[model samples]
Structure formats: C-alpha cells, structure tokens
Target: MFSTVENYWIKGTPKEQLMDCLTAYKKENLLTLAENQLMPMKKSHTKSKIATALAEQLRHNFKITVDQLTETERHILTAYASGNLPEELTEPQQAAQATLVAIGYVYLFKENQQITPIVPKELAEQLLENESEKDTDNWFLTTKTTVETIYGRCELSHLVTAWNQHASQPITMSEAAKFV
Candidate 1:
C-alpha cells in the first residue's frame, strides 16, 4: 500500500494532495486500517448460539464474518497477542504461521533479512479474553467504527497503475520526495 502511495507521488501528484488522498483512502478501508492499530486478526467461528446469532447480525450490519479459527491458529494468535510467540518456529508452527498469514490473521514483515510478527497486543488481549465468538465479532465492529471515526478527519487507481509499471525495483525515497 505504501508502494501504491509512493507511485502516486512519483507521477506528479503533490505530496500534500497524496496525503489527503491517503487520509480518504484510510477512511474507506477501515479493515485494512485497523489491521495494525485497533484489532487482532482472528477467524470468526463459534458454536455458541448467541455468538452465531450475533455473528449473523454483525454480518448484516458490517459485512464482517467471524471465521472459525482452528485450535492451532487460536493458540498461535493467543501467543502472538501476548508477545510470547517465539522469533523462531518449529516446522509445524511454521506451517501454521503460513496459514495465518495466508488468511490475513497475521502479517509478517521482513527487516534486515529477518521475518517478524506485527501483532497488535491489545487486540490479542481482547481475543484471548473473548468467551464467545460474539465477543470477537463485537471487537471487530468496535474496530471498524474506531478506524472510521479516527480517519474520518481525512482514490489511488492511477498510482496503482504507475506502481505496476515500476514493479521491478522499489520507489526510492529520493524519487518519492520530488513531488513533496
């Protein structure tokens, strides 16, 4: 997403204008915005009747569903939320990690040749304390609302096209700074 924004700046879009665009984009993509700050990513699945009912209601209202996270994934999410997940993983854990990443329940970042988790600690705590899937769904709603409210104070199709044009190499900071 940063790449998309950078590319826009590269194509004669003013930085201040791009910042405004990003502010608007953030307002529009609440789930993507909350991925880091407001909520832990977890599957929305539950057998509890109340939770099921609530999930249905939430789905209707927010278009978000609670996925039924596997037991292993739940454990991993718990550990990640608590900041206890190890930097190194066993073979099985590695596979589980891959699944979590694929499902968007977790994100991995590469830095200095090392991969790391970008767990939201508070969100993890909420997930760990959730007694039912309804609680989890409620968290999602709260996060969505929060992101919208926070960025409400703040459209990049062309930028994406420009990014595809230069996909072979990263957009340099210097190159990006020109528009600013």
Candidate 2:
C-alpha cells in the first residue's frame, strides 16, 4: 500500500481520516454501511455510534468482504496501491466503489479540495498478504454479465479509469466486474 502521507491522500492516520470521512457521510449512508456489515442498528443510533462501530468492525471483518469483491472492485483497490489516479470512470464502477465504501473496505480521503479514495494501509496489506491468483470460479461471472448487460461492448481501457471521480468514491458490490 502507498503511504497516505507520502501520497498526500490524507492529513492524518488512516483510522482518524476514516472517521473524519465517515462523519461526513449522511446518517442514511452510515446506516447502509452498518447493515452491510450485518450489524444490528437501531433507529436511534447516533451517527457517531454507527461510524465508530464500522471502524471497529472493519478491524476484524475486512477480509471476508475482500474475498467476495468483484474483479473491478479489486481493480479499484489495486489502483490505489500504485497511486495511479485515472481521468474517467463509469457508472457501474461508481456503483461498485460506492458499495465498497458502504461496506467499510474503502475510505474516501478529501484533502486540499480533492477527494482521493483509499483503503487503510493495514487493510491493504491484509488484502495483499495472501497474494493468491485471482479466483476464476467463485461467484457468478460478475463482470462479464454485469458490464455487458449494462454497457454493451465497453472497451477494457475505458473501464480502467480512476474510481475516485465517480458519483462518490467508496464501497458497494453490485457491478463493475468484467474486462479483458
């Protein structure tokens, strides 16, 4: 994982920066995050509680979700590893990124007027810790079917843009799964 400081992607430690970003999220968004974690949330739960719970939960649960990440979502995180922010992104990419955010696997760091999507360095290490070959038969063909179904015949290069510039950068897992 790239250094958040060296990369200038954050102003503080990843955990602190994550909370800062989480607090900026709407309560509804936080609620989505909690639900995604399978954490029971009360209607009266304060935003702080929700965000804090997610941060803490992520300390233990990042791998489970990472294991299930669609290929494009994994690509999104890999982009951050290399500090290569691209110029364009697609709706399906945005949706997948948003889902990852909501799932607490990704954090959006906003500094000096630019928003850069990041995962905690520790989490990034954990993701690469195993460094196994991509599983080709786990879930359904997430990318092939999802992309072709949504944006017919999109080129591989067009789909590789930075995920940070979409509707919002973060977590989710519905699409953004395919390419050559």
Error of 2 at 1 (Å): 27
Query: Model 2 — TM-score against the truth?
Result: 0.54
lDDT of 1 at 82: 64
Per-residue error (Å), model 1, residue 108: 0.6
lDDT of 1 at 24: 26
The 0-to-1 C-alpha lDDT of every candidate, in the order given, reads 0.41, 0.61
Give the Å error, residue 27, model 1. Answer: 17
Name the top TM-score candidate.
2
* Residue-pair clashes per candidate: 4, 11
Off by over 4 Å in 1: 1-67, 131-180
